[model samples]
Target chain A: MSRESVVGTAEHAAESEWGRLSSRLILVNLAILVAPVVMFLADLAITGDAGLQALITLGSLFVTFLVVSGIGLMRLFTTRYRVTEHSVELHSGLLFRSRRSIPVDRIRSVDLTANPVHRLFGLTTLSIGTGEQSTSASHRLALDGISKADAVELRRRLIEARDARRGYAVPVEDDGPISELDWSWLRYGPLSVWGVGGVLIAGASVYRTLHELKVDPLKWGFVKDLEHRFGSVPLWYGILASVVVLVVLGIAGSTATFIESWSGYRLTREEGGMFRVRRGLLVTRSVSIEQQRLRGVELVEPIPLRWARAAKLNAVASGLGSLDDNRKRRMLTPPVPRAEARRVAAEVLGTDRSLVLRTGLTRHPRAALRRRVNRALMWTVLITAVPVGLGLWLGPGLVRGGLIGGAVLLLVLVAFAVDAYRTLGHGMRGRYLLTSSGTFAHRTVALRQEGIIGWKITRTPFQRRAGLFTLGATTAAGEGVYKVHDVTDAQGIALAEQAVPRLLLPFLERDPRSAARG
Target chain B: MEDVRLRPPRHRVESRAVNWWRLQSLLFAVPLPLTFGILWASIPPTRQIFMWLTLGFLVPGLIYVLVMPPWRYRVHRWEVTDEAVYAASGWLWQQWRVVPLSRVQTVDTLRGPLQQIFKLSGVTVTTASASGAVKIKGIDHAMADDLVAHLTRFTQATPEDAT
Candidate 1:
């Protein structure tokens, strides 16, 4: 009999139970249910009120964990799934009774994730994303805490089922390592601006967590005996020591996150035009992108990364929703050299195409440079005037200090403005618009002009005086709008008209010389 | 698409839009200045500074309520073609947008309770642009309907291009 015939004959067909280890995995959730009681115990300890009340509280906490664990265990026993030729069915919920089925063809990606706990237990949580950007949380079906063997088997069956339904084995061919973990890139890892702040925040939270448990953090992890011991050292020495220690901690934290997220990062071009990036050490993440969904790529270079000549490659894929709060920017490559980033961008966008991301950009008019400089000077004066004005009003001591500080600040501002002006470039090559702009962390995006849905022209009173306008090419792809600010009015209009041809040309009043340049 | 004209639009909105905008200006102006006066009146140290700045602000605003409405009406222009919708607004700091009909996600007609009293309407064309919606206010009711119908039909006729 055919597969359909066999499924039809069976009763509730091919229902299978996950491994018994899933019950043990569910026990971890008991801690959440009993956390309040634990906090109460900590409070009692701190207050020195450890009597019958403390014993009773501890007993109640134990009972709560027991009951929660029992419910979690019950859930695992009740859950069952059926994999048919057409659909994958899941049934759970003891009292409410919920059933969900995903059609084989609708499955976009099957990803496996595991935390440190799950890794120790040899378990995996499989998530099936339908590639839907809906607000509904049910867009992904997650099978929580299954045996490694069963999870692997289920993943294979689901993929094979999908393949059988569609009739082809998507090549899982090895593409011979696109990128490898190297210490050279590690230097850029800690160079992110967020690192120091992230480390400090994380450290404060950890200290708070320990404090809540009535555990002294100074004794717990941070340098011990520094509580009152810091007073013995000279103030400057203490401050300097702490600064050095904090910087070391920040760099360490940055490297840890970098390794945790992109340690085993590999980008492989699979069969049937699907590319997958599998990385992370303790908590693994596997992101897959279809060739058809990819509109373009973005080179993200933070100020420090830029100075180091390194950039991270992020994909501009359609219908791709972001995942995780951090570490989930849909990146294609780790922090690599600028040359390699350009090469990879070309490769991702396809070298087969006439348009490449590494095209020479056209510089905007001299007026744009002047406008940037003007803006910088205006900001400098506004910032400096506040202190200097207060200095004049308050006393003469502040006047001397204010002038010296203001002059230094003005010089820095001028340098940044000149750099920003130098960075201003816009080019249209083939079907792409290659635009570059930024004072510090410069980004050069090669966006497809066809992806642009609209155009916005902005001209302030000052800009109008300078004959400058900001042209934003609005697309659905990367970060939405790519703007070339402070371009001459004629250039802005011309860029819009040339990028989209007939669309913007209809509304714009054309000037022959600028039109030809665009 | 190639046959589209590069000519500037000649159509002006209904002349009554000037009165409506002035009314809108009044609607916006009254509460804000009154709130400012109340706030600065209650405060002690900055009362003198507030009075001067408020006058500095209110003089231009009073001029706007009386004079800038007609000036704004003179500048604001909108036009629609089979391919796209165009709008130009603002007097000093001018802004314009050409939202391709093919990229329009939604088209809406807006008539507030006050706007309805004037027998006037406004149309908003939403595209996938981060710069926000293209809103053409102070339109004739019948003209608004025509715009909505035309934009709806035009957008529907074009197949969605994948991002």
Candidate 2:
């Protein structure tokens, strides 16, 4: 049974459930756009300038409503799919019509997902990905609304096509109960709080920057000459202005965060090796990720979650081909605790319980030294400049500032060394090497024997002289790169040989180099 | 296998192309960075590092042009034999990946400006649990249309092999 057969009949049209779901979305989007219009009207009523201002706000809302309604109508009416004997046909688009037929044999995987709304409405969305590039097809298909019987039958047929091939495992029947971690681990901790705070601050800063950029010559005083610029304003006035701006920004940023991150978070693994993750406040999203698309597990134990015997578990999936692109993304699960991360990773990757890929704990020898030195120097410079900078900020002559700078410089040097020491100590621990050497937010991706796809060992001219080489393993999800900064060629070969066999076995039976020739 | 070769009534073009605007900001590209480097050389923090990294950015593109073998590369012409679909590309060191259609998990097409301009597109063929996916690049649009039709047809007809 290949992916093609899973999405069988191209015969079905927009009948019952799909129509209802699409209409609901149109209504939801309409409600979301109503806030700004109401706010605008209230502002106009208070100021008695309701004519131009209210019209502009109302017009924008109307346009927004039209766009959302248009997309909903298009999906409801235009999008249709049919499952064929050995393939699936999808017809989509409004003006630029498209018809995609994907054979059952070529399908890699099919994922089904639904949110709380989708669950209540008895509808699920499906994403089917194949190994080819076709314009007529979409990676995702919204069933809108369908019976449970139809959904199960679709899954069964798709699995039959996919499993028709040998070596591929039959779709697992027992996804197992939502683990204890799902119930206990998901929490909004300090990092989540700080992350929310950071977003707030950034948003406020952007708003302020835009406001400042809208320089009003008449109100700010027409500045025709450099001498009369705002920089020449009184020192007290400058100090007061800066303080007011900072306070306003700080408050706005914090407020923005409190509203955005409200969560009705839920993570569940179904009986069919599919993980469903749905969360978000005003704008909700639901993603169903196939187990095969699972990339790797990220366990972050920041200061806040650490004390609660907790950590945020983030599963990076493959649908987002590159972090730089792809708006529709999937996560095996959101930030759960650290202890649960390993178990979740195992379930998602379908690896053994003990097989953990350690992607951290290696350093690029020269790069490591350079980073530490740079950090040390920066701290020294900051300390040295502080007292002198304070003298200029406060007054021209202010209390023997040179001595103060020297004392601060000594303290900074001590702090820098301690911070650099912990960062330098980070390294990888798994059977396959993954080196994470960065001083802050250090991460490396290591895979056990099963997770890796293929391994390549290569050395550059400069690296050869330094007796160093890099081993990069391409995973289904992303690139797994490990650089042995100063290891011998023999060691490099030994590691590559040992690792490649494990990685290559599932893909090709013979040695890859010889297989390439054959 | 004999029935698989029978042609369908319609031969449609299958393509997914991302326009040039889809690529990352041009400010990070070599030409823009080089221009910025020379202009900002006198400014603080821009003298040495900016110029050096800007020059370094050209290495990948230069290496690609120089080392790439002049094969009449067409990603669209990729074929799926009864056993496998042969997707191969490379200029310096070559890569040939054979993905049995039975093992295929996902098929994706990407079209960037270079591909869009040339009416070409790249196809990615992936298999379950294996990241050794095959990519075929620089195929013309018309050729891609025929290839996708044949490949999908072949995949449907062939019985699943031991992947």
lDDT of each: 0.71, 0.48
Query: Looking at candidate 1, what is the lDDT of residue A258?
Result: 86
Residue by residue across A1-518, what tens digits does model 1's lDDT show? 01121233235543343223365567466545556666766666656665665566567767877887777786687777767778786667687666667787767666677786677777778777655432234445677777778877787687778778888777765757555566677777787777778878998887776565455645533366565688788999989998898888888888888888878877777554566777889987666666656666677777888788788887765435423311253688888887777777777777543333334567778877777778788887888788788889999878788788878988898898888888878877766776778887777777777777887776788887876788887765545567787876556656677788877665655455455776
Tens digits of per-residue lDDT for model 1, B1-163 = 2222234455677788888888888877666666667767988888987777667667777887887678778778889988888887777777777788888888999998768878889899876443478888888899999899999998998868444
The per-residue C-alpha lDDT of model 2 at residue A256 equals 44
Work out the TM-score per prediction. Answer: 0.79, 0.55
lDDT of 1 at A368: 75
Error of 2 at A236 (Å): 12
DockQ of 2: 0.06
Worst 10 residues of 2 chain A by lDDT: A502-511
DockQ of the two-chain complex in candidate 1: 0.38
- Docking tier of model 2: it is incorrect
Roughly what TM-score does model 2 have, to 2 decimal places?
A: 0.55
Candidate 1 chain A least-lDDT 10 residues:
A1-10
Q: Which tens-of-lDDT digit does each residue in A361-432 have in candidate 2?
A: 433345435445555767666666776677777875553665566666656664554444444322334443
On residues B57-104, what C-alpha lDDT tens digit does candidate 2 reach at each position? 656544443333232232123445554565434322333344445545
Q: DockQ winner among the candidates?
A: 1
